[model samples]
Target: MARGTLFSSIAGGGLLIGIVSWLAGTAPAAGVQQQSPGSNPPPLDYSLTADSQPQPGVPTGSLTKHVLAPGKFFPGTPHNYQVYVPAGYDRNRAIPYMIFLDGSGYAGNNVRVPVVLDNLIAKRDVPPMIAIFVDPGVMPALSDEAQNRYERIFEYDSLTPRFANFLIDELVPEVGKSYNLSKDANDHAVAGISTGGVGAFVAAWNRPDQFRRVITWVGSFGNFRGADRLPGLIRRTEPRPIRVFMQTGRQDLVNYAGSWYLENPRMAAALEFAGNDVRIELGEDGHSNRHGASMLPETLRWLWRDYPQPIAVREPQAGAGRGIFAELVPHRELLPPPSNPAREGGAGRGGQPATPPPAAGRGGGPRGAVYALIYRDKPWEQIGGVYKSVASPAVDKDGNVFFADLAENTIYKSDAARSVAVFRENTRGA
Candidate 1:
């Protein structure tokens, strides 16, 4: 294994491809290809190159740097932990915090969390919070020929609380020595991408009392490191205090362990089944940082919404969402509404009360011209505000028509004479 930035530790050897294929169970897909008998193992191509460098010029407002206390986890070896303290952080008032696994990767390459956090906090898109980026610890090597840096797979892949404990019992208290931190789990979040993503979920699942928010990008939930059983476990285990955000690309790794697409969605289903507040986004790219970078800011906003609010596992009502958004635009409202008495009774031709048109407008009939309501997405100035469009229109017994704006989920009403009026706005539970 290499020892530079943790992102550089990706095993680029050919064995990794073979390992991935085997883990993803490519045999079935390959078996259909009809190969010769006794073809030991397929040729491995592990030269899959991807970006592993952190981007430059990230804004770090109020973020502080903290060096880990030597002799804590990897005794006698010191490591650096980067902390991003959001604006309005008060020593007298404890604030929420986030712990980033694979710190070197997230802090540098993907999402550029420091910059996003700074901008979001400044704009009040999310509450002020702190982020602690910690890298994996390495054990001392006995000799040049006999070295040990395998801690990544062990600490990251394990389902036990050892890793979580290392952070809460050791690293956290050490940081507390310098700053005030709320011990409430709801005030804390843990996040990462790839292997670290799975590790983030595991930490929160094992100890929700210490971490209630989780964000994972391209999480490896496959059989590697005994993580393949996570879905089944989540199905059986009681729900925990976790609001999760997951993202993966269709082109992500496809190996014996399975594509991040298949595994991440499966984990998402499990999380949702367990009543965890989870959001999963699928992309079209491969195992890369591009999508993650684009989604980071929004994902963080969703995760930290209502910080201390305990994540509840309420079964989604079968018809609640349907009724909530169904009948988006009323049928009659899709066309122009009928006119007043002039067009209502009969008569209407160049200022002269000529013969009436058809019963339902156009066609030709004795009854006045009955115009149909038509829906439109036109910009309009109403109620002292500007609106994009009108949707979910309804008509009253008196022939008054109304509509709601899908963009803002607002309702608008029009008189029987086709005059538009503002009704209710700020819908979708406001």
Candidate 2:
């Protein structure tokens, strides 16, 4: 079979989609279709032709390459990145900035990001900004036979806060040492394709204080280690000062991991549901750089539109209602009293004064009443039976204790009645 056909058969025509469709009672149809809020329109051809190249009167920018040594976040790995400084850049002033992942693939003539930036900046379509294109890291092999460790999946696909920390704490600061990059989050943006697209979203989502604009193309928001939960998170968390633009194709990857085509629409809907500034563009293309590169110029324009006008966080819409946020936001009725009335010399049941409880840490008390001394050579009574190993203990409002056992990979709960039971099992090898 042909390579493309083989991949499609393995990914789209496999048991993964079949099982999902069976469970949902509907099968996903083939072909690309726009799934936006309003009337869906055909995607425009943003592909660069002869007319799209460098034009007269447009000042060209400088492209420089640099290497970043692995830092505390991803030790022993190194990365290569490039920077595009727009023409007429002044070192004295802070310039708007953007970071793109999968750097090498985007810096070529086909993408022509630098050229597009020059034209856009000259036309006043986008603010003159510095673009940092960073490639994924790689760990060197110890021997000839051993394969080099690819850091792409771990750095991009895994939804860990460490990647964001690496970008904010390491990469940005390293870049800022030479160039006067804007410190304002609203002046910063992140973009990437495929898995890198998800990484861009993760960076902005985790630290909206550092990045307010995000552009993702064919983001891998599938079962790649909890990324599928992003839509739910967007609905539940307080809306941030973020402007997002997502582009995906109908024939994008559809495998056990997830369907890129469907995930982006879900993300856009969730963003809109949370009252965020979001846009989703669908196309008839597949998982490739052609569509994304073609749309890069327009994407930047939309991202930096109304430049210097700080992106604002919107109030949660009442009509949109709340997801987990409703339970999280503090309310007066939900708060417990500062002090327990019954414990503070107030009447107990039947309007009678409650008995004064023994004072803790006091010198003298009734022999058996001084239970605080239980640790002093006394036979300690176990409220609940012992477990192999206990960790991450927590209690609820009703005095029910919850904990996890790492050895057994089980979560257990002990109620106020001292009864214990397994709360959960097989917690993803936790």
Candidate 3:
């Protein structure tokens, strides 16, 4: 029943999702979050960028739909998922992929995600990847008059890992049967809006081994289904290896559930407080995903920026919120390896059950894993002043950069205007 330009692919198959029950259901006049079906959705409209629109030279991708009926996780419910393979997607190679929790809206006309991905891929802003638009399961109607039950709220808004487990244990493996999907968590991303947005974060939070990048648009993060506990959980638990991009509108007001606008910031603060990589955009739109959709291209770019690099777990930061999250999480054992009660330390990956011998010992023979050079956000930046070899570098009080070129035996200064000129010549390699 869905219609669009469905291009053929080298095995690129992802489903398009529609509105979620949580998103589409406006609980009568008691909730002012949504408009009547006939009225305009957002209070104010957002402008889509050129990247979000199709261009003549840009190449589009192929999209295919699939269904997971009577899935083991949610028995008797039918879940339909879609995959979008970008132009020139290589089926032979295991390519990075992203998941859309609530499929229809994003995969369908509302977000037109495949179109945006095509444009960004053309510009090389984001790598050529596959997208999985997974719709929540719907129970079959028992009879002509019996209504089918929607599983959106139960699955998307829950604090537990059941939904994520379904994706990992069932949906992903099923989809992987068709395409060479990346198994690396760093190569995976998850996204959603509204309750789907909460679901996205919850997925990455519970299963960082499956997805490390997350984007949530106007996530319903309040008390509904214990999501209000996320900020506290993020602050208390060991920092997960995840990167997040979030957006919320000031007008995404409070309801009987909680404040959409407020919860997003709380989530962002907790992520930042834990020293995780996170970016958030606050706009003037409402609970709708229009503004977030407009920024989708940028969001993908940010989420997938510096790919192939491993996303590492970080120690909590050092500040006020940091003070709360700074303490190391409880491990099975507290003592050093070989001495702890568990006595099984210094044995496995990241040491043994109790944290193995090395703080100094673990066994990889130096070249320590933690000491290995890892790239986080903005790992290394080019500050414009480039020379063959720099022996000394200094910055002025006013922020001008000065460096000495060792081989050239000259010192150069890059002023605030970013102009590189010789400050002193013939320094004699000092």
Candidate 4:
């Protein structure tokens, strides 16, 4: 049985995972990359301020706050949650979102989240998405003079799926009361730092249907009371609908708990091998929010790169090694054939065949769908099947094309026409 806090509601339930599987990797022992002196620099103490800009078209409204009590097996504890209303968010127009763990971290120390969000919305660097900042619960002491008790790790570090249930079932529905949150999974994101980072991955890993985009800093994916077995579990399970951006420092925790440096890279490699959508940046610093904070603007941009796009999990071809490690994605649609032969071009949900349309001139149109891959630099050039889903296409000065594979967790170049070829996998270490 799993022991952890759970948030449940009528519509759907999510779990806060606690136990982890510690399976190993396939990389050669000799080529493992270690954190370098420059990369593993020290962490920053204070929060860094962000450069703010105008935010037009964002839904503008006062945030509605809430304090709910845990019940049943949960002990009825109280937790705080906040909603961010963009400049022009409308009930009619559904908006995507980015969720935050530990509201105080971003709302206080790293005020840059909202600031960067405002700037990004204005500059069109990314689409406008709502922000949900939540705090872990703390039970009140019996005596008046008793100190307020904290339960950060005990609640966040576990691998059970209860916490995710709380957000989707309890937190999200409550947010829906004030504004319209897109029910579509493609519009959602989740993020955190430290143990919160591990919790973030656990949430998405358990409920990728609700959270397709994830950002974590210094995740604790080690064997601490059974939470360190994620790398192996990832290799064993079929890929889920997720896009993960992981960041960690060399100087992060490396005590009896586990090494953040070693764990982050190992997890990244496993995600790649299991055919997941993942990105990682290894820095030299301790286990703090400084680096996670500094990269907030860029991270948000990457997390929401493929906005309003659904993330699909590609199964490996038969007879492949381990079978589970092979995955693929076609995130973008190629330029339509001058005339679509299949009519609609894209497949139906669940990769099922689409309904047949009327005759060509009467109502039937082009049904053919080409998985056209395009380059950011050369929009005219047609690249096919480079990445499953991409925030933006990668293009070079000479019309070269490249894209990241979430499953292999690698970046590859298509043979001039975006044909698939191996580029680099971050297995050895960072």
> Best TM-score goes to which candidate?
3
198, model 2: CA deviation in Å?
0.5
What is candidate 4's CA lDDT for residue 38? 38
**Candidate 1 TM-score, C-alpha based:** 0.60
Stretches off by above 4 angstroms in model 4 are 1-65, 71-73, 145-148, 314-430
- Please, what's the RMSD in Å of model 3? 20.1
lDDT of each: 0.59, 0.69, 0.69, 0.59
Q: Report clashes for each candidate as comma-separated counts.
A: 25, 0, 15, 60
Candidate 4 displacement at residue 275 in angstroms: 0.9
Per-candidate Cα RMSD to the true structure, in Å, reads 19.8, 17.8, 20.1, 19.0
- Which portions of model 1 show Cα errors greater than 4 Å? 1-60, 69-78, 148-150, 315-430
Could you give candidate 2's per-residue lDDT for residues 1-430 as a string of tens digits?
0122234454545544432232222433321122222323445464674324889877899999899998999999998888899998999999988898876656665566788888888989888899998888989997999998978778987677788889889988899988999899988998877778889999998889899999888788888678899989987777888998887765566666666766776677678656677766666556555576676777777788888899875543333322212112224223312323332211101121133333322222211212233342468667666778889987664446789888888888877566899899987546
Cα shift from native, residue 380, model 2 (Å): 45
Q: Name the lDDT of candidate 3.
A: 0.69
TM-score, structure 3 vs. true: 0.66
Please give, for residues 1-430, the per-residue lDDT of candidate 1 as tens digits.
Answer: 1112123323544434432332222422221111112223234222212222122443345656666765654565455677777655688988778898867555652345676777777657777777888876666576989775546667777788888888888888887886788888878899876677878888998888898888887777877777788988986776776788887654556565655656776676566545567766655444544566665776777877765566666542222211101111134322322223232111101131122222332311211122212213444434423567655655554455667777877787766455666677688722
Task: Tell me how far the alpha carbon of residue 337 in candidate 3 is from the true structure, in angstroms, after superposition.
Answer: 48
Candidate 4 vs. true structure, TM-score: 0.61
